[model samples]
Target: MIKSGISQIGGKYRLKNILIDNTPYHEYFLSLFCGSCVYELNKKKANHYECFNDKNPEIANYFIVIKKFFKEFEERRKKGPYTIISRYLYDLLNAGILTPDDMIEQAIQFHYKIKLSFASQLKFRGLIPETTSKKQFITQAKKDFKEAAKNRNRTEGHFKNSLGKTTRPISNNDCGILTPLNPKLEKRLKYVIIEALDFRDLYNRFYRSYYIKKGLTKEVFIYADEPYPGTEKYYGNLFKPEDHQDLIEICLNSPFNIMLSTGGECGIYLDALGDAGWFIKEVYTRYSTNANNQNLTKEYICMNYDIGKVHKMVMDNQPNIMNYVEG
Candidate 1:
């Protein structure tokens, strides 16, 4: 299992298996709106061409730099802000103080922001703390700031000193920028095509041009994990209701295989996809907003092809959605 390394709101880190089991056979895979790329990172890459995309500039830049310049990213992470001061750096990056030319530096700041932000959210109001109260959190934040200013590397020692005989081991999730790099994750991402494009544009770019136009629609699979209906605010309120209709229309009319995952809280998905002859399955998943917040919910997986039939067809080595197109 490969880790995404950064935490993101509405990420599918915990729902990897459920999503995988529902996906049909494909030679090409596209993860549109690939937040944290939890599915792409964990999926079997052998004999598959995978593309990871996100419209969010910061999130996409993280993948762009990490995929091509992972060595430099790890080198800079060692000296980057690992404490509460990361919030200041995040602000600077958003303010355009870090020139656009320095993408790797910007990627480092975005990484810290997501990891350190409240509940691992990009637009967070406060810092994440193991303790519940505001007073304790503020006190710790101040100490962390001082440590970061005094010596960047000393932040690790500061955390150790603060722990002071506590049995709880230091974790990267708790330490933000101090999170170690996973070589396996880097290797997995090496061949993945990274794109920062709107969902519609992305679909036309690869899904239509490369596969549909080439008469290879059945060989490609697109998975969309768009921000759920009520939770659009967390994603900067970009995916509007009209966009949902547009996506549904695309999937309904397309010859290629497409699957969508949602939290099952929205009525539009059930009403639209269900009425359009798509297969909708309810899968159990547990979502954790933070260490203390966990909720078990049903995820609705909507797909054009039936997974059971697809699997049987794949097993028989016959011409089907996995390989052959219907005349």
Candidate 2:
């Protein structure tokens, strides 16, 4: 499971409560960062000091402070950036100052303020890497900051669109299922699942047809395979099973009920959920009979199913069972 917390390094005040309660955009940003932090911390055993050695000590210390801060808020992990923000808003609603209606707009403004403040702090502390004659660290920082601003704007736009509309809270029973709020947006919910190795084209296709067009219903879900590690030279040793877990949680919790998984790789998580009595539905992508093969027919079999349906398929198509992934 992923951990959560609040920072003690930064003082907690009424403003923090108001900011968290009122701002939807900031909530989204913080949730994304929390997911990313979970991926990093779980994947690497090293402390922040060791992992961020390239950064200034003060900058690294700030990250340590952040890590500690979020550690206090670990129990409430929700899906999607919006839902994550909503979780914080819900907490603020308990504090008796802000109404649920005020959250989305407040969260957006707070998110922008946090980003700007953090960036300024980094610059003020000289923690942002100094530019060299050959390498332009300052230029890279500027580009990254611009990108961050752009993404924040996009999130803010989405949050603004949610105002004046009431969103029904999703229940635990609706976990794996998609529920449409608007009938007109239903078509955007159809999704195609592909191996992470085959993700390039599929990602482009999904973004162009669904995400970019803004045609997606709140219910449409994408189930993507996790990418294979070591595909990039710089990231060779950086990938880990936990990183995939973080990615899976992010997708599972998104505005659209999209899901991404490397089916086999996610077995650990699935098994854990199953042990917790969560209902798991197994969908077979392919099949092969060879028992010794890593990707085999039996492995794809549903744990919840008895011998009836699967046995019938196996008996009817013996040849199909031999069509395992090529070694």
TM-score each candidate.
Answer: 0.77, 0.21
Q: Which stretches of candidate 2 lie over 4 Å from their true place?
A: 1-216, 227-239, 259-261, 271-279, 283-327
Q: Give the clash count for each candidate.
A: 0, 26
Least accurate 10 contiguous residues by lDDT in model 1:
311-320
lDDT tens readout by residue for model 1, 205-271: 7855766568787778888898887777676655766688787777787777888888745788889
Report lDDT (CA) for all predictions.
0.73, 0.29
Task: Output the TM-score of candidate 1.
Answer: 0.77
- Output candidate 1 Cα RMSD: 9.6
TM-score of 2: 0.21
